[model samples]
Target: MAKRRITQETFDDAVRENMEEFEMNPEDALRDAVEQFESQGVDLTCIVKAVPAVSSDDKQEEQTHEVLKALDSLRIGKDSAAVADVTADMKCFTEQCSVGFAQRYLAAQKDAYPTILSYCKKSVEEQDSVLTALSALAALTDGQPDLLDAEGQQFLLDVLKKHQADSSVTCVAICVVRHCCLKHEQNRQDLVKGGLLPLLTRAITQHSGCAELIKQASSALRVMTFDDDVRVTFGNAHEHAKMIVLEHNGLKILIDSATAHPNNTSVLSELCATLARLAVRNEFCQDICDLGGLKLIMTLLADSYESAVVYNNNNKELVRQVLSAIRAIAGNDDVKDAVVSAGGVELIVIAMNRHMTNPTVCEQGCACLSVLALRKPNNCKAIMENGGAFAAVQAMKAHSDAINVQKQACMLLRNLVARMHNYSQPILEMGAEVLIAQAVQTHQDCGDVGKAALRDLGCQVELRELWTGKHGSLAN
Candidate 1:
């Protein structure tokens, strides 16, 4: 049977009743409340289970800390609140939440979710209060996704629906939605069912000129396409991905947005990442290629690298995201050749060589090459000739401890040798055999792929047998 649970308000009311009516001490009251609830089979996991002190002289209530006190201040009748008071209280709550996770976790434990949610619901009509209240909610829900109940999800969708034309409000609302949907599967489902796809795509189309809004909207759209919730085993991530592309024209909107933000690397990076997320189907991958996505991505890749001379760190991320998008789009066979024909192989090799120290860039770079060389023997020769083979070997050596880099390098080596046997000897001459052996020895997950690469490169690999064909059980 499911366990019975009580709200923080109910438990606090019980503790107060024990102290004020029964003349019990604070400790005794707390103990009595705990024992009573446990005896009634009520779960106290989420309840704060504490009593605040009362100032007898002024009859004012004292909370555990300033954040709780601020939350308490906002709990008064919503209609009686002056605009100035609401603004100040929201700022205080938001500032406290911004300090650290300790304050945010405490506020969440003390039922601050409903209080701030109520403020958001009430302040929807007033523009200033709406942004202020939404900002507070955003800060509060940062690391506390569980606090986003169904009502909170509905409120977020309603905010987007009413304020779709208002860029400022829509940006803040999308920020909150991103916070809630990340790592929370149910919120993603609830929001999607509430018609979130069209709103997000429309926001991107309407605010294509606004870089900040575009980034936020693109990120929220990507979050919908993630299967990242830990509590639930299965999610409709693929369904959501398809919905975004097929039903909402997410491909065109994102591509157009990326085209609009030529100088803004951050916006371009986000759009590229979203593009990767939406390319879950073969047709979608072809659609991306059909929609001039390949040309746009190649342009962004070159532009971001050139701009990296001043901002290396920021542009490194852009490079990684762009490479990831390239890898995703290259899942199609025809697009694979298109990428190579458009100087993608040389550019990708250059990007990998430049960002050799960044493991993610190297990983994405090798994965992209592996996909490009999957069935095309000509492409494998191209990768080997353009210093692609040398780049992969150096990436493996530079970030030897990075398992993803090692795994992708192994896959790339295997793909290169899987079709053409001559290139393996040249690749093995680069001392790749030692790296493949080391990866197999260090990472258990890399055993199969590493061994396959070794075997394809004309190196000896041990084969293990675990099953005997003679029926029954091993014990028998």
Candidate 2:
């Protein structure tokens, strides 16, 4: 037989016969009959109204319950299948969920953080559990670190103290500390004063063989000592950060680590940054020199510009730290001579030209040059010969908003004019006087420096009398 065609009546007749034979529901028979028609050439959009629906609110409520259950699994001294399941869910939430989910979950789990802390606090021997707990804590506190309560704060410090021997634990603890103190100044002070500074240095010493651990410790130190306020904020009578420089032997630790591993530029950069942070005060600067910290930094800088190692770009940050540390150390005349002797002047000039747009580099470079030029005729001659005057003024104009750069440039120019012999002629040739006036007219903070520079050049500043009391820029 060729082909047999079935009408809608015939298909319905067959479906009804089958349904009666099978005792199927009449609705199921009709629906299956319609699906058979659709298999050929049917547009079901007109035939179907909608499919069955599930409640998203129900799913969300269930998920919320799961989160709550997970949090509950994190009770103190608890390590079971439930704890692992909760950890897995928390990991997923931290990694894949949104901030809304995090906030909601965190709000629901009133005791999760402390309980997790307590759970891990006793399991120092179980590195994996401790690591998991720490990672979970990090995820939970990423953007919500301010949610860390006083107990949680002390709990973290205790974790560090308890697990200081384990490099992995130390690494996690440092990461936790870094995120906690990143923008929270008071917390940073509390942790440091609580003896975290000395602990960091000791870790640096103990974990010299572990690159990752050292890197983590160095990074934590850098973050803690990063800000200007943190640099000056001491924890004890040791005058705050000076404890790091003096009492804790932080300077020596950094120097030794950098020397031990020359290729680890990340560690070197962070370590140098920590040193720079502590090198703010004169005693710290002198300490840096005494401990040969300056030499270490200068070597790192020279290496960045001269290294053939396949990863030279890694040293740019090291160069930045070196410049900043040198600027601070150069405040003293003895150290200034040492910097000049180390060819720091040429390096600063090169860095200035290389990083013409980086305001921090320019600021520190100019400040270092200014300090090197103070009361030193030969160093002034070096700066003048290397076109430092041109670089300084250009930096001032380029970053008019950078008060530090402007002040340093003004001071450098002032020293070049007043301290150096016959330096006024080159400054005039370099068109520095106009920049000086512009610097003063523009920056009220550095106006006195600008006017002093102008006067040193023997140029009658437009506001000559304003510098004394009528106007004040800033102290030299």
Candidate 3:
């Protein structure tokens, strides 16, 4: 061969000639081009551009079909590198392709789902990576109800069943099932029947990795428990809640973890919220109250970190759940005294003041305060003495925009006036009359507030009747 000096033109012409041979295997061509660029120090981008593009309409469709087939095969393969590359390609294609291309790519690869599931089951160390890919795949098919048919649903359930004991796998499996359950009621049912609750209960006590896995597992359980089909499935959730509180020392662990990892707001919030739900009606409330659950929650609510904002939201929810728990346990005068001594009222007042803009927080804080107020008349008096009445009344008038907040505030006001009529004097001094007037005027627009304000007003009038023997006139 004559001495042919290599130039950019020569390299470009070589790549173009190879690319023009349509009979050549595309993967082989790509591999050869990559190797040539590596040897010649040529920019791969230039080589890629120089390659001939499939031009004929039929050839273009065929090339597209071939790529899809390759993706489907790679998705099913055991080769991690190949699977990762194909997954990346699929993700890019989904983002850049036409709707028709996306639909075909998703639908035409239904046969490969089993392989995907197998990869999920086999990739022990890379479980999170695989799960991330599975999540994306599930999202693609989420809008297509029939994309994940009975077979696909069954495959997911199989993975859950197989890896229920592996914490990492269980975490990913939960997310996969959660994605599948978004629009499919049947998949939701399948997840429950596949023993999700037992797995979650086990994970709550057993999963020993970073707290994130536990939190994610707990969150998944929470989501599953909300489904009507799965709600009844966790028939033992109440019993389990009691077990968590009494047997596992769950309240103590949650408090410690929340305090230690205050920066991991999501984990801390989930753990606390889960504990609160568990403590709902269990006799364990007394144990938890004795173990400082209330104090821990209050401390978190008072913290100034961003996590505190999360804790504030979750604390409001916990307060609602723990209200019944508080009533059941704090019925004892001594326990009631401890709640006050622990600064529960002051914390409630602070949460009310700080999170007034969050209606749920205001409602839950007010509800908890009402419980404390009813149980301990002295504590209620302390609240009034400390300007809580003004905050409560402010929440009632301004926060009336939220029905729950209005209801909770009205209920607290009613309890205050009913149990400690003496506090009503201070309440009136704090513009209680004006606030109540505003509430009555706007009550009709809010459901819970309207009903609650009417009930509270009637109760106050009824008390006046009982005291003075006059139905319509006040003793004054």
Per-residue accuracy of model 3 over 1-476 as CA lDDT, tens digit each = 33223433455455545667745555556567657666765544312222334435676432323234444555645456433545665454334222343333333344444454445445434555555455544444533433566666665666666666666666656655555555455655565555555555565555544576667665654444343343243444454455545555566655555554555545756765565565555355566666777665555555533234454545455444443334444545566677677766776677677667767667776777776777567887877766666777888766756766666677677677666666656666766665665665676554344344445444342112326555675555
Ranking by TM-score: 1, 2, 3
lDDT of 2 by residue, 1-476 (tens): 33334443345464565566877666677677667766765543322211212225574332223334455545432554333445675564344313343343443246566656655555545677678777767666654556566776777788778878888888878777876776666677788767788788888898887777777777777666545333445433235466666677777788788776888777777777777777767777877888888888778777776664543456566677788888778877888888888888888888787777878778888888888998899888888888889899789778988888888888888888776648888777778877777777777898788888888898997664534564555686
Candidate 3 vs. true structure, TM-score: 0.61
| TM-score of each model, paired residue for residue | 0.86, 0.73, 0.61
Off by over 4 Å in 2: 1-83, 96-112, 115-119, 122-125, 140-145, 182-194, 222-238, 280-283, 308-314, 400-403, 464-476
Tens-place lDDT per residue, model 1, 1-476, is 88898866688788889988999998999999999999999987655556764524555544355677777778774557844576877798899888777568778887788888888888898788889999999999887778898888888889998998899999999999999899999999988999998999999998889999999999999999999998999998999999999899999989988777788878888999999999998889999999989999898778766755664676988889989999998998998999999889999999998888899999999999999999999899889889998999999999989999999999999999998998888999999999999999999989999999999999999968778777776684
Q: Return the top candidate by lDDT.
A: 1
lDDT of 1 at 391: 95
lDDT scores of the candidates, listed in order: 0.88, 0.70, 0.56
